[model samples]
Target: MTETIIPGTYIDVRAEGLISAGRIATGVLGIVGTASNGPVGQPVTLALPSQARTRFGLADDPRNPTDGANPLTLVRAVELAYANGASTVVAVRVAGTGKTSASYTLRNDSGQQIAALTTRVPGSWGNAVEVSLQDSEEDCLVERENVESPFNGVRYAPVVPSPRTRVRVVRGATGQAEGFDVVYRRLQSEEQVRPTAAGRFFLDATPVEAGVPAARISVRKPGGVLVDYTGDAIVYETGVPAAGTVRIDPASGELTFAAEEVPAAGAQVTATYGVGHALPTTGQVLLTTWSGDLDFADGEAPVQGDTVEVTYLLDRDSCVQVTLTNAGTVERFVGPDADFLSARINAASQLVSAEPDDLLGNQRPVNDEGLMGSGSNVHGADGANAGRDEYAAGLAALENQLVNIVVLAGQHATTHGDVLAAHLALTANSEHERIGVIGAAGSSVEDINAHGMADGRVVVVAPGIRYPDGITLASGHTAAAVAGLVASVSPQTSLTNKPLNIPDVDQDFNRGQQAQLIGGNVLTIVRKGGFRVLRGVTSEGEGMPYSAIPTRRIVDYARYGVRSAADPYIGRLNNVRVRDALKSSLDGFLTRMVDEEALTGYELDVFADRSQEIRGEVSVVMTLQPTFSIEFVLVTMFLR
Candidate 1:
């Protein structure tokens, strides 16, 4: 049995039958509007409601119709988006002309400029921002200093101590207040008073013309932050080995030093880099160059020209004390720039803050040779240039982005050109899978119908929504509200028969108003306790594919399902096995949708004809029966 034949030796194999795909969330909302704060024309993803309040500064209150801070439309819309179950939102703040951030520069005891701080964005909100820096109490003990390794030429310490302790480097002397603090995982004992005596790591070391360079080395810190030797990733700290003495070769990732200013024998040489955002408020500070090297004994020394790594950590020893002076009074806000740093001194308080950035300027100093580009903060001006063009640009920013619903909060679709731009964006070559919701402020049924936006991609609401605060905003303001209601429904669920019973909706449509809204294809708040969609028709006439919201949604879902399912089989062969696998996957997806009640039934055919099969084209044909929502019911009652 062992020498001749093994009849029973076999391996069990499993054949894949069907591959199911998880449903993608087509519920990400995109809103474009003006704000009192935040980066202008930049897309910021909002995960929580508080981020909108904090970053965008949407906390201002307007007294009447013509308040200067009238961007509250975007604010309320963002609030509704979260309240109505929207999880992720992309908010773009479009700034007008001449918008500039407020800025202030600080000077040290010797009249030397220390740090320049500016607001995060261009707006009037920056005018109230105030910033101050002081020494942090957070500090670490210099656990074991070494000057042996060539990586750290002067006085270098390891990235992390063997005993595991905290270490922070203050910009000035220890315990000195009013000085910008610098925190690091490792400590530098003393600065190299003489550059000629200190060994320099050549950033532009000559390549050996073959294999990887022998002079190649990596500078790193704790938490896996590797100093980028290739690009302009490393910024030298102020003072020490002056600029131009060290050079970086982006192509080969090399760091060479001038021949005369090489590190002393057994000296550890290293550099430092910063990382974080540059935000200015009341209590904030920035970090400069920070690095650490190693020292080894006789046998511990490695081969010359070999790679070496330096590591360190940065920690806050104490808080910065900031005194903000707006108008006349001086208010003090103390602690780190993080909102959660202290419950008493949070971001909501009158005092503002400036967040730290390690990699400021990325070696692009404003004044000197060793200054960082990101270190200085400059408040920009918010001119009157912010308008429809800016709004259109903001909408353009959402092109090809994964967004399902779009809310043009402040722009009235009846008159504003921004609304037209938004509609055109949906049908652009980008083919964004989204629906736009816009409100028409104070416009009558005749006016809305005259605009003639027959596309089902956008919906216009009329009769402006009224709030309980004795203020009735324009009809266009309700777009965010409608979007929230639509978002509350599941992607698999249809909104054809859905009723929007949102609180704080003071205005309701009467019988005549409802008829007018239906005739004009406008959405309105029904008077019967909650709001009900009177008709499912889009801008197009009845019986069209996009007529019913459910019809459009299910079609989108089907398209999404098929595209997501078939993307994997693109490069595969068009043989029988591949065709069968694709058919099974597609069939399995449709079967699940049917089982979930999203579809009544669906027929999916992969490689339906021989002609398509020969051209290496996988022809997919799907005949779908959408799950219709019941808007009308008729019953005959027999007196029994």
Candidate 2:
């Protein structure tokens, strides 16, 4: 028998209409028919219905019965139908008695029922044979070069192409057909591969209709580990050959890969880099103890001539005391470098006469210069020139004697006589009596006596003389000369006409006045003395004999004579010195006393010291007390 083979189906089948047309009569007909023959040269066309024929070994309708329906062949048929672009196919059914019918149901690869059919029915002249074939491609070998099976990394394989088979191609190595072009073309025409700017790959290169990028293929390892691609181009080496899965999407920069536990926790990471800028700073200046003549360095120089006050912590309880030594040395006339003798004289005069009392007293008498007189003398010759020359001579003699008297008075008062007495007598004689002579020329007793006798006789002989002879003679004569003259002049008496009765009344009056004046002047002098006397006496006379004088007689005398002196010189001097000394001493004493007492508020005390001393120059000490005994209280009440 001749047979036909179909690609992707059955291999061979019997020819149609080859069976006898008549049925055998039991046994006789069966044997006779077996020997009977038809025309030997005629081709007998076998007749069969289309429903009974199977195309590609499949029934026209899948509902038709075949040899129990081969499920494997059916499944193969569905796969080939899909691959061959057929919508549907039919399976052929065979009946009993060697007859067949084609009524198989049609179906697509999805098993959905379909209507496409190839059916046939055999004639009843004799029994017939039928065959079913699937409309599927044969299971033939399809060889490919470098065709990668999606499941494994095999390089070459002869595969039966199926609808579900996923394949890819690379370069071919041998005669096996390369499917790379076909795969590439299919991929290009249907789905494309693209690279994204993020260096990722995507299956569909075309942009989405909504203007979004194509979707990418991504794959993650266990625990969601992925492979990331930074925008920069990077090369990675596989130290060992690896056949692992990776997912990537070129259009979206999405990549996924598995990492082998990450070496340690944070491996395969990136670090960000940057730098920081420093801020500008203003300069500063530093100083040291001895930076030169200036307090700071030259770069930090101070303003010109600026005064800088610095403080030091001293062990002492108070600040150092500063005193001006010999401040009086600046005096224009009697300064430090002046002639010592001259300075001494001037100082003495200052001590005696510069008192507030003396300066404020009555004016000196007018002299020939038309100025107040200092009681210095003018002279002329006297004796042996009576009337015509005697007046001139006697006046000269009186002037000469007057000079001696002043000299005697100064010398006796400063040296031999009491200073108080000399001062008073000189004051009285000069201010009141108006003695004009200050020094004498004659030294001999006889010359002085002659001078005095001539002047004294003139006073008695010419009582009408405008200037008295006695005053003139005594004014200038030296004390020695006067004493000598007084001694030489004697009362020459023969039986002495009873001693002349000298009245004690006038003597007493004069003596009392002299004493009063001396006492008053002494008080004035003591009071006017400066701190020099006080400090000097205090320091030097610590155990001396006369230290009490300043506190006693001197103070009493000043207080008593404050109103008694008619001239008010003593009173003025007393008031000024007492006031000044009292203020100073009191200030010091009270400050200390108050500080010690620790009392508060406005309390006050006044004090004075009155004690006698025979020798010391200081005659008084005085003080005033503070109102507040507490320093803080005083500071708050008055100082503030």
Candidate 3:
């Protein structure tokens, strides 16, 4: 496969509320929720509600889905936040420690596993993934000309038969042969043609090998040739067939001619002819890939047309392809077969990872489901598994993010108030200054008041909100809605009568109940014409400074702006010149804030002592007078 451009995790800056050029993002919300899929303990930024399903995956249990279940918590919470009015969200997905990944095994023809595919991250959503493999082969042909056969020397053919008969003849008297008036006798002997062990049919050029026996053979051909009787004018048997013809007996060493072709009666004749025998054919080798031969025991093995054809299965290369499907989204990966398939899938597949079994001989994975691969749906993911530790890990992951508001989805803030409170305090001390929106969802007003959360950084709301379907959710979900509302508007804007965009609440408070909830420092929402926040207040008790939501946010915003203004002068000289320039920058930013009405008035002082200047410290202190929304209006009337 070619190189793939992996999609990035961060959302587009244009879609988000962040401005990298020294401006703060005041509308970003950070949330933690349990999910069925996605990298746990990592923060992922996204703007649209649809992006949540694509990045974190859909429900774990597709057959039975729930808004409160872990499989649906993250997605539902993000959708709710967006529905309220959040433009950007930094969401972190978390699961329990004992989470598992969905996996499948692939095997070869021998029933041994060749490779395996697994989910990229641990969760039950990966169970939807499936796999398939295909075969790739080529043809192979073998010739049988020189192949060694098992029956090489045992099978042969005979050129000459046994018990052959031949007649002998006498030579002339003038020939100095041993027998001038030789006795005429018929000779009989066996001249067999045997094959060698290596399937050779011919014998060596020896005296007795070619049927020329070394016996009492006095009238043999001189030098094994008959050349016109070798100057013996009266030669008969020694003459070539051009002058006279003769036949030789294989055993008796005698020569005879046809009656019409015999020499003259008084001429000298010589018995110079010899008999020869032909060899037999034998079986030979065929091939290494295929080895067999024709039955040559009954007759001579044919030597003219002894070719054989062989065909066999050839071990060839293969290609393996894998597919990962989840929530209607599909990703396909391809690579060479066997163990090499794992590398390509791991590098390119965003939905699932892969592993190969090198010890199983790297056999090509078969296409059969039962023989090669399987899909499992045994991973666990439930919202209850995420304890406080998991949420803490999620919070840690979002610590570096530039978020304005934080919220917990589908969970009660009262259950984990200590952890959330500690996190917000730490973040505020570190200058991040993000406020958390929490709610005692599903609790009575008395229970909410009973729970003590006096931290000014946290905005606690009471009595969960209800949906259009008549289902009332917990306060934590309402907290998510409130967070979205907070992020949509400016920090200085009051949330006293802002529309929460909700259908209704679980219980609308009466005047006394509202007074009790407000007195207990809970940001209570009531239904008038539509759902709107009754009064915005922190958990901080009555008459406490910084108890208003907007007041806290405004200070945080100004602190961020002031820091942004002064951060550029850190490395410069710590003398009066640099201090004056830094003060001027702060004045310019605070004046804009005053003009925007976030502040009523302010004071500025930038100074450093001789010892402080040596240590490169430039301290700037500001007296900020924040603007507050009017809550009461009493008219003075006189008798006219």
Q: Rate the local accuracy (lDDT) of all candidates.
A: 0.54, 0.21, 0.62
Segments in model 3 whose C-alpha atoms lie over 4 Å from true places: 1-21, 59-71, 136-317, 369-377, 380-384, 609-611, 636-640
Ranking by TM-score: 3, 1, 2
State TM-scores per candidate. 0.59, 0.13, 0.66
| Every candidate's CA RMSD | 18.8, 75.2, 24.7
TM-score of model 1 (CA atoms): 0.59
Count clashing residue pairs in model 1.
Answer: 64
Q: What is the Cα-based lDDT of residue 448 in candidate 3?
A: 75
- Model 2: per-residue lDDT, tens digit, 384-443? 011212122222222212111111211212121222223324433442211111111232
The best candidate in terms of TM-score: 3
